[model samples]
Target: MKKWLLTTSAVVMMGSAIPIAWAGDGLWRHVPSTHAHSSARAVAGGPFAGHADVQHDWQLRSSVRVSRQVLREAYLASRAVYTEKLQKYAKVTPSQAKKAIAQAHPGMKVEDVQLRNIRTDLVYTGLAQDDEERYLVIVDAGNGKLLLDRLLPTHHERVFSGD
Candidate 1:
């Protein structure tokens, strides 16, 4: 009976420890990359020449942190692209940004406008008509601000081969 009781207690203790191990939830382990770029100066080296060890040595110390930073930058750039497209195509002015939003999206007001400035490699908003939603407008692609008109998305003119 004594041996059985000791065995049961040990099993019960081990089982209870499992839940405790899960408290970290693995979220901290994978901090995400965006967090690293919150402060641009936080990470050094060059446009993209820094070594992993160098970046890890900074305030952030994990791949997840670097990823979090990259994501945030991408989001910001996306917003900038949206705004720039609207302004260029729709001719939305800063003073008239609100008015354009109202006109483009009737009955529905602009909740918020985000700007994104992608890297030079990719097309600014894929070089299209630039308008995604009636409520949301791409004011200009150059500056990356929101606009007020019914901007169209990019329309690619395909080439016919061997006609």
Candidate 2:
């Protein structure tokens, strides 16, 4: 009876310990890549070069499972393509960009303005202060023509917030 009691206690203790170990392991498990394009190169040597590392740290800190590859692509694209397009296409001053955003989102202040090159279109993405919305004002960089004005999805508030 004494031996059987000791064996049962050991089994119970081992079972409980397994779950604790599994839980710890689960925290560090590799997250699957989200982007379909696996050929995308890892970003290096630019203003946004360390973006992947920063994103990894943020993922670990927040316990979020965001794909590192997606972050790397964004940095690579922005540095390699978007920045150049902005300088070439954007004839308007930052204040003018802000004014355009304000006009669209009436009663809301423009918090930030960033130029983006989405495919072939050059756009000014403006953040609104009140609802944390992003307004995409498409502009022709070649001739300074305003193309499209629209609001992106609401969830992008987190993206614009830099969180």
Candidate 3:
């Protein structure tokens, strides 16, 4: 969810592929790329670049940390639920859930498909939209059971910057 670290050229190249940064259930929405700009200072080397091993060191240590963080964020509601172990257990993939959600919601556009934690089970959630209307559809990842199908507020488009 903390996508703010995305570099400028990377963000611009990504464009629409930018995921809708989520906050909490209804507290998330799409952040228009209009505000994503590159400052010269940001693009250029900083004063410490020549003096420190900052970039190289982080590049070396970040892989494991990044993977762990992403998995950790997946089950924010159930912090103890270590989601790195999810692949071995989840019967349903996000793509499968997306197809099912689209089939169920007809004209709804699937904005994002993410893993969420409800009670103790891993749940797959689909953030969807139809015109100006929004919807949230969830299914149990373990048994493929429908858990939640609800309409969200229409104007709930406040951009989340992972804060």
Candidate 4:
């Protein structure tokens, strides 16, 4: 055990000594750390500095940020198109849609009305809720006819079919 320990210590000493022979510094190599030194951060935020270094100054603008902006703009454009379709094709007003929901479900109160396209059909979808249950009622956008009145599940896995 003592021979093994001596041999291991000798190997470690030789391994450490090689770096000291190659480069004069035995303590640290030329590898940069993952994060900058705390002194650099202190100097950056210190009062003595003329220009304040914001967090964004050091943060990289990644493709994820670009994609998020692109997604937001695309959503806005799609919403504008939906709004145009609602104005052009929807003969029924929001009040009429709410009234349709009220007629079918006596106790349910219509909370919000939205224009949505289910595949190819444009409908006025309304979220209705009573004391215990919630429902989603759909009214035909073209002729003001009641299309679907279904109870929305409280918790369920949604399977979306996308193009």
Cα deviation of 24, candidate 3, in Å: 16
Model 1: per-residue Cα lDDT at residue 89: 48
The backbone clash count of each candidate, in order, is 47, 1, 0, 0
Judged by TM-score relative to the true structure, which candidate is superior, 2 or 3? Answer: 3
lDDT of 1 by residue, 51-118 (tens): 33222222334453335575455555544544655545433345455444555456563544433334
- Tell me the TM-score of each prediction against the true structure: 0.23, 0.36, 0.44, 0.47
In order, the Cα lDDT scores of the candidates are 0.41, 0.54, 0.57, 0.64
Candidate scoring better on TM-score of 1 and 3: 3
Q: Compared with the true structure, what per-residue lDDT tens digits does model 4 show for residues 16-105?
A: 576575444322333433455534753565522222221212222546334557545555555555566566777877778788888888
Scored by lDDT, model 3 comes in at 0.57
After superposition, the stretches of candidate 4 with alpha carbons farther than 4 Å from their true spots are 1-81, 156-163
Better of 2 and 3 by lDDT: 3
Badly placed stretches (over 4 Å) of model 1 are 1-92, 113-134, 141-163
Which one is best on TM-score? Answer: 4
In candidate 3, the residue pairs with backbone N, CA or C atoms under 3 Å apart (3 or more residues apart, or in different chains) clash, namely none
